[model samples]
Target: MWGVFSNFIACEIGFWIVIILGLFTRYVLKKNKLGLFFLALTPVIDLILLIITGVDLYRGATATTAHAIAAVYIGVSIVFGKSMIKWADERFRYYVTKEGPKPIKLYGIEYSKHYLKRWGKHVFSYLIGAGILAGVILLINDSSRTEALLRVLQIWTLALGIDLVISVSYFNWPRKKDD
Candidate 1:
């Protein structure tokens, strides 16, 4: 029983780590896909940890503690995450303005066009990710510890990838007002 509890503790560590690392990564790559994906994953991963830890995911102390921790993780990820990403984004603009070819700079459209292109990319990217996930799930027999590890890795990879795309792509275009 005590051993089972360790899983949750380890998961908590992973969640907090994601929050810290994701924020730091965003500081370097303004719209980094990896950072964004981890940010989005913190909560979901925590929830999964709770379930795997034999905690009654939505009942009693475990639920309360999980929610509290998740709230803190998400809050920090958002506030620090935004500040870092914004600073980095400014740097990116500076870099691109100076280093990227002039033609590319001139070709850069306001975010709307970028968003349109992203939708198509996500469709294919997610399909591939999902396929990989399914293959892993099927290949691993659920009767062993390896299954859990594979599940964790697969979900993290796909979730993080998705978060990365969603997170950074939003920055690609300034939001337009609805007519």
Candidate 2:
């Protein structure tokens, strides 16, 4: 059983690596503007292969828990993707509009904190999204299943695409205005 157990451990490590890299890239360096782009693109890349080539990303051949974990990850990231967008907008002051930075408010309370200061939302969204994505994978495998999975995946793609465009624009904002 060492084979199975070792594989599971490896799977968890890989998942965290991607997440840790994202956290480091976005949190430590504060390059979330760029990290958001990557964050949005990774799944799109994997999704395309699943739809066209019928090959799984995390699963080379056997559908493992690793694949399921990755799916939850995709869903969560996209769902709370707006938070990352807001974080980049306020923290980096990228794509600054004529309006000034508004305080982050939750439930009518002025939180007055960084968007990422609320890691709970990000983690929650990531987990939920991953579950939905795992469901999509099961649907995709069903020979009798329709194209519904593709449609759901497309919705996320479109949403992420919009977020990506907005994020890229922020990067172009002048430093003078950011100060």
Candidate 3:
């Protein structure tokens, strides 16, 4: 049990280490392509981890709940990792180096419209992500495959709902009108 858990933990650590290293290299060290290159390779690490898990299962080892969660985690992270890291870097840089969150505009759309569009993209991205993870989960022969896939869908749905609420609330707020 500890062995399986430790391996998954190591994978998680490796996952974050790659992201952080890429982020630091790209943003902090000013190596934009290098950073993006590192971030872009995150899915490779995920694939490797998945392969490791699959090999273990092939060797007659029992799959645990931890393995299922790890699959979902890797799937979601691979799909959203680069964009999430980019978004965080922007906000972090803006807050620390400039004012608050940077305002984004597309095709003359201002704050709320911009955020709505962004959130819409996020929703679509997460849906695609969920589909990818679901397909992968379906391939696994664990007893919890259905539950794990359902959990992925549930989490993304909840996230989209929260984002919708925040975007709409911010758009409808009177104080920030015409800004």
lDDT scores in order? 0.48, 0.46, 0.66
Q: If both were scored by TM-score, which would come out higher, candidate 1 or candidate 3?
A: 3
**Deviation in angstroms for 168 in model 2?**
36
- The local lDDT score (0 to 100) that residue 161 gets in candidate 1 is 71
Q: How many angstroms is residue 162 displaced in model 3 relative to the true structure, after the best TM-score fit? A: 12
**Which candidate comes out best when scored by TM-score?**
3
Model 3 lDDT, residue 51, Cα: 79
Please write out the lDDT profile of model 1 over residues 11-111, one tens digit for every residue: 66776677656655664555568877876776576456535533332222222333223333333333344444444445544564353223332123455
Candidate 2 off by > 4 Å: 1-54, 57-60, 94-179
Q: Give all TM-scores, in the order shown.
A: 0.30, 0.33, 0.57
The C-alpha stretches of model 3 lying farther than 4 A from their native spots are 95-179
Candidate 1 scores a C-alpha RMSD against the true structure in Å of: 12.6
List, residue by residue over 1-179, the lDDT tens digit for candidate 3: 46656777887787778777776786678798998787777777777767776676567565555555566566567556766777766765676446456844333236667778768777666765566556655666564534644665677679889999987876566224345
State the displacement of the C-alpha of residue 138, model 1, in Å, after optimal TM-score superposition.
34
RMSD of 2: 13.4
Error of 2 at 85 (Å): 1.4
In candidate 2, what residue range of length 10 has the lowest lDDT sum? 107-116
Colliding residue pairs in candidate 1 = 33-164, 37-164, 111-173
**Per-residue C-alpha lDDT of model 2 across residues 26-85, encoded as one tens digit per residue:** 755778776565455544533532342234432333444443434544556456545544
